[model samples]
Target chain A: MKKILTIAALALSFMFLTACDSMDSPSPLDTRASDTSGELNPDGLPGDATMGADSGLQDRGLNSINGFDPENINPEDIVYTIYFGFDQYAVGSSERDKVKSAADFFAQNPDMKIVLVGHTDWYGTEEYNMLLSDKRCRAVSDYMGNIGTDPSRIEIIARGEAGATMDVAKNSPEAKKDRRVDIVKVK
Target chain B: MIRRVFLGLFAGIICTSALFAEDAGTIRKDAGRLNVPIYRVAITSSDADTANLAKRAFGTHGSFRLSAPSQAQFIFDFAPSGGNSVKLTIKGGTVYEQVFSGSNSVEALMKACDAAVMKTIRTPGYFAGKIVFSYSKNGGQTSEICTSDMVFRNVRALTRDGNDSLMPHFSPDGSKIIYTGYYRTGFMDLLLIDLNTNTRKVFAAYKGSNTGGSFSPDGTRVATILTSTGNAEVWTASANGGGFKRITNTSATESTPSFSPDGRTLIFAGDYRGAPQIYTAPATGGKPSVVRTNISGYCSEPVWNKVNPDLIAFTIAQGKGFQIAVYNFRTKQTKVVSRGASTSGPKWLNDGRHIICTKSNGANRQLYIIDTETDSQKPLHTTSFGSAKEPDFAYTAR
Candidate 1:
């Protein structure tokens, strides 16, 4: 009886020790990593681009959207398409030149309006990918806003993981081309 | 003459003893039912289409084992009733006859099979349901909403936007389909397709990502994901696409808000606790509590069982791929249900015992019907249908 009791106690202790060791304090915070994919620069602030931070959207020279169609814009009319990392929406410093290039094109064509369409690689769930695409779009629009463009002029759309490039290896560098945002003129 | 009479009497005595020996507990003491793993059934139909449909229906279920008529405990005999219906006479376990109707032969035969299951097994049979899924062609460049019977026949596109459409789900009544499409605006908007009216309209186009539209059990409300706040949050609207209200007030990007069978609760995938996990909230919107699946940190795409309220199915990360897992609310334990080739996107069949999901094949994927009870996968399509994903099922009586 004593031996049996001892064995049972040992078994219970081992189970307690081994049970849920994986649940320790946010096991593998891929959630945080994915959430922070929309990280902003210097402090990831202004992350809440709610309706493009809509407290003063109309006050900030909001453009009227009546007969604008992004499909009508030619490939050459597009200033620059922003590219992002895997599951990321952050406009990194490397893409600053591209954002500036779009902003410069805007300066050249003040009468025209530009549209931002966001997309992602087909790696995550469909619904989340849809939101992530929007996050990337809002991030670029916010970037354009920071660089002196009418936030209203930048009509944003999210294509999610649509049109994912599959002609090359998925893990290869060329796949980054799939996670991009197009900057088309919507005049 | 006396010897002949004695021999006849002996034969009669021998026959009487043989009959007595075959009585219960008198012979074959080990002939018990302790070894049977599945129900043995025999399916026979004069019509080739009916027989083929019945075979497909019974062959894919794990609870049933198709066998010869002599060895089966149940026998299903089907007869053509009309152009697209069948009259099934089930003989064994319980004897009954039922007339099943559908829009096509496969659908009708499936309904008859489901009737037999209900009459014999006393559990839900989901073979006669319809599935709405998004099929992507041109290498995932553009997708269109499509619907088909459970057998993957009767396939037709609901939307030919020529741009992109995805995450198609059926209303409770199976008369409408709700999905997100890049219709004209180049932005993803919640679009509704009423099968009865053959008309399409925008359900929700609230200035940002509007997707993940699902119907409540009563079909009076819709649960969706809205990004007007710059983050994906659970929101509900009226059945007519009015009375918008946000359900979750958090920075954690939420997706896929599924209502419980009782229509009193909502389960969704969110990163509230720093990672993606299953969480539940009141249908009227309150503090959300995480469901401790404890299976993985990357659990998402949760769909609540419509028949069994205690069950919720989701996708869990497996190595570099993903697999389907089920969580029981009563036991609070989670178990993996499906395997192989980056399978994800689980939606419950009406029986609550099956799920319609997708399995990846490199860049393209295909739809599969999974028997959660046995982890058996039956591909809905043998031929390629491009990349089919995000499947939702609706069960309606014809």
Candidate 2:
């Protein structure tokens, strides 16, 4: 998560035309400031030291990757699961009320964290469905983000056709019912 | 794995040195006509289970016609040895007879059969590989990650019941597994199960979805789908599950990042060009280039062939269902190799010629081994344990 890896040297490149990588050496990339502590300093580096302009670290984390507390504290389920449209991640206008419900839940329980477990119908490949489900989670998260929900308190999981019935037709309402995100409240 | 296979040539067991001298008689004369080879082989085993399973494995390849010892070119005789080992004696084969041991007799027999494959067919035998998949009972959301031999022998539960554990991938050596499990926090977080220690820990508890965790070839780094950054993107972490680094920077959803056998490039699926297409990016941060499979508009879950890195196996959307297709980089053409009610989630066995995938017919989702070279598909195991999907095979040499 915003990890600044030091390119201690520039010569070592992964050139072992083999299927195995020994856990040896200084571990080519992502040295993580000091250790694998998962701790970030204010500068998002090990300490407050300003990163060198030629560090080439910004290219690594152009998209910020951050860690979250995985504690499952007194989790509760929100009845309204954010249903995504067929092969779509955008939260429908009708689903806005469900997002409001989540917003209201977070507002009522200020110390709670929201877990958006994503899903998809039996429409495409498993991996593609995973991404589609993930975008659904993000859509709901972004909507709640507009409601001022802290991203840190939200954990999104893309389940991707995990719960869908295989025998049913692809477009059946039972199958489409699976293409949604289940909301859970955690501490 | 080809690297290991080459290295295996020098350090290979004394019995398997005849790789180049494999008998050509077993290969059909007109092979490339349909990518199928029908070899006449005979299996002699005192154990019915061993013979039946071996025949199943052979038939699953859509090759090998059962024949008498006198008529067969490759003959295999299996006998239980002192321990959990199988003593395989070949009468009509090139390789010398040897003993293959495993945790049990079935595994031992598979090891022997796989060895026999290398000796006669000149290819890796994945029958001895370990398979990990999520098993859902009666099509429920709650599932468990289970491990078994290729034929579903010695099934062991890694995760518990009443929790969703999906897409478990095997590390190169078959000693560790990384999967997206919600058994812990009720939210999908990547979990690593050390098969040796029988312990599991959170590999990626990132802010967003952490799914599709697969190990890099050499078993050093793990490629996973972490959505924390922007959208779903391919990210790499150390084998110890630390020092995370993002590989592909894309706003389009990215899933299933697989390292080339050389571990230099990554082949993954992204919707950047509208529909899902296979794309390759440098293992290090770089721009991603599209892999024009052209077989279909939707191709996802791309995995590099371990034995033959140039070959790629992915799920391609067919007329109404999806099937496994192999795209040969050299020919720049794709071949659809599987025919199922709905087959997807294909992972290559040690043998580049064969693949392990899931075939769903009605409510029955079962693991199957498909011979891409012959377009032969056969069930690896039964649905007695429930439906299985997303199988990852870790082939360890015997």
Candidate 3:
């Protein structure tokens, strides 16, 4: 009877340990220090919120003045468009989740390649918009790299107003839909 | 389209019959509403179809007016060939009487008219010139390069790659065209095409981006933008793509570099000061200076007038859109050339008084030629392609 009791105790202990391991395993994106509060850095980059004084995200290659989250993104999602502010390449606090989600998707699909096509509205010059779109794509690429996506699997394209999702004039609310980076999966 | 026809009909019935009919005996120098020089030409064709084609071709032109064959200063006669060809002859008060043969009767008649005007006015004729522009196809995913006459007739594709090709610029001598192509998707390819041979080659296909190519007036070099070294900077290269020299070194983007008539200076658009503005620099590369213009908003795509060196036309951001504007160096005045709608890509015609630009209504984009002196803009009639933009003019002798 004692032997059977010991065997049951061992089984219970193994089950508890397995559950703990499952909970303790770090996310593929967790290699970089994260904000436990799920709050994004106001600087449009990602890192520990407590270390805001330091340019934590800047050192990680993020150049945006605002932040976005790409967490909890599914790789199978057909398309994801992240919009930007007026004449701004900064992914703001409200948009950080998209970045985190993109990072999560990239992490989940190791062999997948993504083309981040950046676009702008018809407000600025074509040359200026081209550069602005490029800067936006760089910001996204930096965040993806920060969260453990292989840089080689990512491509950035500055489409300017060429890939505009909305056909609206400048200064209109609908025009804001054009200023975006479309994350398209190629693999 | 209705407005254009109404204006034409109004001028045809009211001005031609009422105002100018009484003054037909005297040479009406300023008969049209625009108050420009008037040249009356009588057009005659061997067939009624050819005669109707000639009338339609010349109706939209802002230059000559029609008159009775006996009282006309110039006479244009068209002889049709067995096929789609026509032999055009122009003779009258000018020392020019020539017979030119071409495939299309309409195009042949227009060329004959242009030649006649050039003989009388002693100015460079734009009617016989061709324009190379970018047209969006396959739902804007790809763009094809096309060439058309100034009247936007007889359009032929220069590229069938169905890729995103933009910013077509004519070489100084009109023998070649240089453009930026996206045949490789995310990569840019600077392509050069020989108009005579219809052959294309990669002029500068760098890794990052290659765009904004403009040939120098001397045709010895080309100024363009390359991002091979981090950021987009203005760079000049040999006409044959042999030697390359970087022109601007800025963290910001520099683009659309055009050379002055003397080939000593270059005017380009840059955002070094945060907002895009026109800036001038020496062709040999040196410290750049801001263009002294009265425009307060974003300015870009500044092209130096080939005939009038003192005038520089550019695109300025306007109310909910963009418009074409000209900055006069001699008067230090800035005048808006385009009106009512959004216009971009202001490229100067050889006439120095007119410019070709892209005008959009947030849905459709088309090419329009604006006369700066009159502030009059007319849409170019191109083949029913998707959206046509970025037109470059090349003068071809007929």
lDDT string, candidate 3, A96-147, tens digits:
7888898787778777667777888867666667767877877777777877
Q: Per-candidate TM vs. native? A: 0.79, 0.78, 0.73
Q: Which DockQ values do the candidates obtain, in the order shown?
A: 0.11, 0.10, 0.04
Q: Quick one: ranking by lDDT, best first?
A: 1, 2, 3
Model 2 clashing residue pairs (backbone): A1-A65, A19-B217, A19-B218, A20-B218, A21-B218
Error of 1 at B347 (Å): 1.1
- Interface Cα RMSD of candidate 3: 20.7
Task: Please identify model 1 stretches exceeding 4 Å from their true place.
Answer: A1-74, A166-171, B1-37, B93-95, B102-104, B137-140, B273-275
Residue pairs of candidate 1 with colliding backbone atoms: A31-B275, A163-B141
lDDT of 1 by residue, B101-149 (tens): 7877778888888887766555667888888888765254567777777
Give lDDT tens digits, candidate 3, residues B1-398: 99999987776665334222323333424322124445667878778656654654444344556778987766777767545456666655222346655456556655665665555544555666678888764245567777776654456666656457788999978888888765433345577777666556667755356677799987889998866565678878887773667778887778789899999898998877777889999988898899968685688989989888888999888776788888889879887878987888988776666788887755566878776754557766532345778888877655
**Per-residue error (Å), model 2, residue B13:** 25
Supply every candidate's count of residue pairs whose N, Cα or C atoms clash at under 3 angstroms.
Answer: 2, 5, 17
Tell me the deviation in Å of residue B8 in model 1: 28
DockQ of prediction 1: 0.11
State which docking tier applies to candidate 1: incorrect
Each prediction's RMSD to truth: 15.9, 15.5, 22.6
- Model 3 deviation from native, Cα RMSD in Å: 22.6
